[model samples]
Target chain A: MTATLPGIADIHHAATRLSGLIVETPLIESQELNKRFGGRILFKPETLQRTGSFKFRGAYNKLSSLTEEERSRGVVAFSSGNHAQGVAASAAMFGVKAIIAMPADAPAMKIANVRKMGAEVVHFDRVREDRMTVVRPYVEQGMVLVPPYDDPSIIAGQGTIGLELVRQAKALGASLDAVVIPCGGGGLSSGISIAVKDASPGTAVWGVEPEHFDDTRRSLAKGARVTNEPGHQSICDALLVAEPGAITFEINRKNLSGVVAVSDQATRQAMRDAMANLKLVVEPGGSVALAALSSGEIELAGKCVAVVLSGGNVDFGTYAEIMAAA
Target chain B: MTATLPGIADIHHAATRLSGLIVETPLIESQELNKRFGGRILFKPETLQRTGSFKFRGAYNKLSSLTEEERSRGVVAFSSGNHAQGVAASAAMFGVKAIIAMPADAPAMKIANVRKMGAEVVHFDRVREDRMTVVRPYVEQGMVLVPPYDDPSIIAGQGTIGLELVRQAKALGASLDAVVIPCGGGGLSSGISIAVKDASPGTAVWGVEPEHFDDTRRSLAKGARVTNEPGHQSICDALLVAEPGAITFEINRKNLSGVVAVSDQATRQAMRDAMANLKLVVEPGGSVALAALSSGEIELAGKCVAVVLSGGNVDFGTYAEIMAAA
Candidate 1:
């Protein structure tokens, strides 16, 4: 049986719960970007969030809601980097121990950052090992498992951003016609869609994915779950999910307008443009929504738009290569 | 005689004038940074400003206040990059033509950005030709000269940031103990100090500068105008002023608690730290105030402090070089 999904009411409760815990990241507008795109583009930069990503919102929401006994027992989770850091940082805040199973080939900076947040790391080979198997021992030891995108609490936590977006946009007297969000497991997109649709029913929600790993796009089109081909490679390490989460996919299917895919090259260009115009550091995954907009994949010439910059957890070597190519 | 220096009243008027024209750049707090520095550090990131710098505030304030006759004749100004873009963009908003005199050796990206804003550029040799000499023809033809930091209107415009800083901090329930601002000719520092001090009389306002070009520091100590030694060089190209501005110095001399100088190396490190932690692209000059705090030049162990990141208009080549060294 499928678990109960999060709704707008849950997101509002999460917002109240996370009032002082997480950063209310700014909704910034760039005049140069507006001039180039021919629309009023507002950027919800979660790159400036607590762990340099929006994953912190869900991680904190899930961990803080556990009972006293569960909190004392600690928690286990699997992620490449962003989710690992989010879980680790949230666990530390709640005075709970975190055991994170991460891919052995993950960016060194991300690995280092996760450890720096006081989490015990269990590395798994991405090609040879299943992350769930690697973390099964810890979960069996009475430690609760914290799923990255499948949990209702996690979805509700991420939905807080959607709520903030509506409030901030209204404060600026802007009525958005569409919102573009970067997608991995569809948790962020689904959560944001629920909140945005509830608050501004007239606004359309769009999800952007990396071209090579566009499982969500296929899933949405087919009206069912779809998996990506094995061994697909992309620079967007954060948005490399093989399939959308079961619970998140259900909500996204109902609320999302459509899903768009952007190429790696386009993502790189968006990163450069963000650095030059927005003065914000954006990782490949974080640049997908912007890439779609700048590459003309989504059309909103005269309308107001919002693009969510999901995260900024890139390494120096990767960042340098991107800047050099530009 | 120096023109009358702008006061709190003028800054309030400037805030009203610039209501929706300028970005209210986010005052962000990084939890990791707070942990490392052992204090609360709020960052006023003007790197996210309209022209990627806070210079836009003063430039817009000056241009929008010009008489109808003055607007018809257009405006002339000289700057390395940030101020040029600010002037060009602001003049364009008011439908006034702008002629900018820039150094021939300025960063190619900066020159290209200035041109992209539709301003007519006249190049001057920094060592041989005076900037004023290059723009004198335009000035003689009845075009108004928008001085970078010396005019009262310009100071009042920049002072609007100080007003925002006080309001944002109070909203967060944080009472700032000190505010460290980057200093060039003391326009930004003097303007912000007036607003900050008037609102929070107990807060200490400190000006930070490049180690070699510590003219403002020297001037503050001498109780009169003092010039830096000629031929001194630093990576902070935007802060190479030899002496403090005439009107700005009067406000700074009376309002600033003290001035501190940071090394080029420290500024570079701060830029790297900002990229890694804050996810903000900060230029060398913009990193000065942050440099002072990170390098222990400012004793802010237990205090709540605010550091203003003044600009982020660096070229890719220079930015890459700085990142590589880190």
Candidate 2:
């Protein structure tokens, strides 16, 4: 049976549910960036969101929808960092227990933050072990599983950002020609695509991925699901998903304008530029959409564009190294 | 002759003048910060302002109000970095010529950005040369002088942020107990003090300064203007004013709750914490208000507080050093 995807109405309901619960992150415009790119570029900075990522939107929406019995039983989730912290914080907000399965080599800061948020974490070697195996025991114990990007509720939740963006743009008396979003499992892109396309049918939605793991790009081009080769390396740990989710891929295939892939070096350069120009702390994964714009991979001259900075959960050591190199 | 300071009416007018010219920055709240401090804290991030600082507010207000003759003759201003960039950007926006007198040792990025914004920059020796001496020729040539923070229009412009905070807090269904603002020449603090005090008469307004540059704090305590001892060093170069402004001090003396001083070490730590928790890039001087709260110098435990992060024009080298040290 095919998985049902969340539509515009579900996203609208999610927007209502998320009011005051999640931050309505600002749509910021940079004059300097506009001059350089010759486009009116609006940045939807989820970096400023609670837990420093948009993952909080989905996590909170999903966790709050659970029945009283399910809330007491708790929830299990797996993420490298951003989603892990999102789940931990959201669970704590609803007074539910969260067991997070994270990779052994996940950023130390992310791991510490998850624990600080009162979540129990189980670490697994990403290279040698499957994350699901570690979380299976918790799921067997009747804890509900909160998938990072595959669930309909999660997609609808992230779509709330798109709703806010459309409303904010209109209030500013501006209209978007296109919107670029960082893609991992295609959840954020697909969700935003549906909402933005419905609100402003003229706006195109594009997904950006790291060069090393362009599974979503390949899948979108081929009109089928695709997987990345193992052992490929990238600094964008957050976008290291080997393939798009089954449900997410279907939605993205229908709604996305196209996909763009950016190099690790380009991502680093975009991070440095963001620090210098936007005064924002964005992770490498979160910088992909910006990288695509800055590198001219997406031509947006004289057009009104919106780029979503999906997260900012980088460690000091890694951030320093990147800034130092630049 | 005594100069007249702008009042609440002037600030409201400035708010109307700056409707689309300036960014109405968001008042951000962090759950992690609230948990650590045990109080609701609202952060007014002027770091996201046009020139990465609130200096733009004052500069734009002053520049936009110039007469046609003054605009044709152009304007001259002195600043270390933030104000220089702000003046340059505002001048460019109005198509007016700007001669910026900046310190030779100001961050290279700031110097380059001033030039990139189409301003003519004249470097001076911060230790041996008075900036006014270099700009005397321009003033003699009929160009108007724009003081960084001493003028009524400048202060009135900065007060627009205060108006926004009061309105935003009301919409959020919250009221502030106190507002802590970073002190440089007292322009931002004094201006915000006037607006916030008038809008929310019950809320207290406090000023924060770097430990080495506690002129404002000492002045408030002594009930008279005081100067910092020369040759003292601080990483908060933006707040290195030796003494508070003549007009600014008079206003602050009457309206301020008090002034608090934070060590450079505390400021650095706060910058790191801001990057980690808030995902915002704040400079040393800009982080002082948050530093006061983090160091427990402001006593914000159980009271709703608002802190202004005034700038984010730090260079990568300096930011990397701080991050590496942390």
Candidate 3:
């Protein structure tokens, strides 16, 4: 399975192909964060993306493979959040219709944003039945099914950030000791680890997961896919996937240096730090890498480190609530 | 006066010298804004600056020019907002002690931010007495007075953004029809107007000011400085300067093509639009250019336009108030 996966070269090609569609968001040095963490920390702010999330990169890449004739039929994706906006926005860019299947309990802000992007929203009860079941009809109706993760195109697209990180570091003449990536279904981590290792072999790549929902960490330790139906609650809903993808697990197991888990308190504090210091509005899922740094889950004594902020799709009200909660 | 004044060439040299002290924020293309304005619009997001404002550039540039003997004696500035943070942060970088004189009525968030930057804060009763009266002694005692926008170094540093806009536009092989710049003390507008006109003579530079504080507009029309009382009401405190600086007014009047004024309503709406569409938290002063666009005060029919978002130093509690007002 590891041998079957595409490496850094494939990801680099995807990045070049998807150039103008995705923004090369600013990689900023955090002066406040450096002092707080006792070492230098650079942030790759994907919150400033076209759809306010790095999901746009993977979504755009997946849609670019479709022929004009196929695009006319449109695309369908099952996400109540960032991926929905990404798919809808990428489809809109292509002048194609997008249908989004969302949970009945999806945030109003998320639904409004998806509709604003010209996507037709179809609601389903995720607790009662599988959302994918509702998405099948759209696929059968000649619509392409855009998976949020667990797809090669998505993984390869995310790996592009890893290539960008290495290039950015070289451009700034900053040598990184580590690059911390947040792990959800592991598509981003798997892809980024491969590219980071390939581009800077001496730089270690660490995956950070919420302590409560540490599926990737467990999966890697067990050397197999593991499910977490055990009610371990995490505020980071975006990174609460039940298990790691089979393809992604194989890549992460071999490529990632290690996996680190941070407490929910650490995640919330990191979110506050990001807003106050970095002037970024990162969702809890996106701030997991920073959480790892703050909690000493990853040592940053004398080394420069870069953290990928996965997305900024948190609703403003949700952010207010999270800050209040913190 | 024009022959004696420094133009784009001198400003360009200053821009090159001050590059590392400032963040080269993105001049992003806004699809939503283009659809509304019937033309392309580039948003230069200076909200992502070191102190959440472009003032850092000017502050750092001024501090960098101090003699070794003077640097050890320290620096002082009279500001209750972004300028205080800028001076404090920049001086701290150079290991210089900074004493900031702030109004007692200044927002707690701003005061806290300045204090966190490791500067000594001195409270002044702006309601009872003049802040400049207190600043005079500090300057007399050999402490440098870093005027918010009335100094040469400050204007030269801000002109760098205009230089960046030209380079960024040329890189894309696109030419700007007009560049919209926000005016407070006219430092940003005056410097930018010279740079833009010199680099691309075809591009017209327009200055935007809040209607409530139209001293700059009045002064330009009267051919003399028009001083308003400190009570001129404006949500944009950063732009509530009593009058345009002498040097800034002379250059702006000679170089700027036009001046546009927008209401507080328009400014608030622009802030909402930035949050909702661009996922940015721009302060009131920062959103004035967008306000001018949305209010139809500045026409952009089929033209490529750029607007500088001067800063994003708004307090979180006040953000809700601004949105509610909108």
The candidate that achieves the highest lDDT relative to the unseen native structure: 2
CAPRI-style quality class for the chain A–B interface of candidate 1: medium
lDDT of each: 0.90, 0.90, 0.82
TM-score of chain B of 1: 0.97
Which lDDT value does model 1 have at B207?
A: 95
Give the winner by TM-score: 1 or 3. Answer: 1
lDDT of 1 by residue, A213-291 (tens): 8998999899999999897788898888879999999998989889999999999999998898898998899999999
Docking class for candidate 2: high
Stretches of candidate 3 exceeding 4 Å from the true structure: A67-72, A230-233, A323-326, B1-4, B323-326
DockQ of each: 0.76, 0.90, 0.37
Model 1, residue B41: distance off in Å is 0.6
Stretches of candidate 2 off by over 4 Å are: A1-3, B1-3
- Write candidate 2's Cα lDDT for B15-120 as tens digits: 8888998899999998889989999999999999998999998888888788877888998999999999889998898899999999998988889899999999
Residue A111, candidate 1: Cα error in Å is 1.7
Report residue A115 deviation for candidate 3 (angstroms).
2.4
- lDDT of candidate 1 at residue B139, scale 0 to 100: 92
At residue B127, give the lDDT of candidate 3. Answer: 58
- Local lDDT at B302 for model 1: 88
Tell me, by DockQ, which candidate is best: 2
- Write the candidate numbers in order of decreasing DockQ: 2, 1, 3
Q: In candidate 1 chain A, what residue range of length 10 has the lowest lDDT sum?
A: A1-10
How well is each residue in A213-306 modelled by candidate 3, as lDDT tens digits? 7888888888888887665778776786778988888888988878898888888888877766676678888899988886666889878999
lDDT of 3 at A312: 71
Off by over 4 Å in 1: A1-3, B1-3
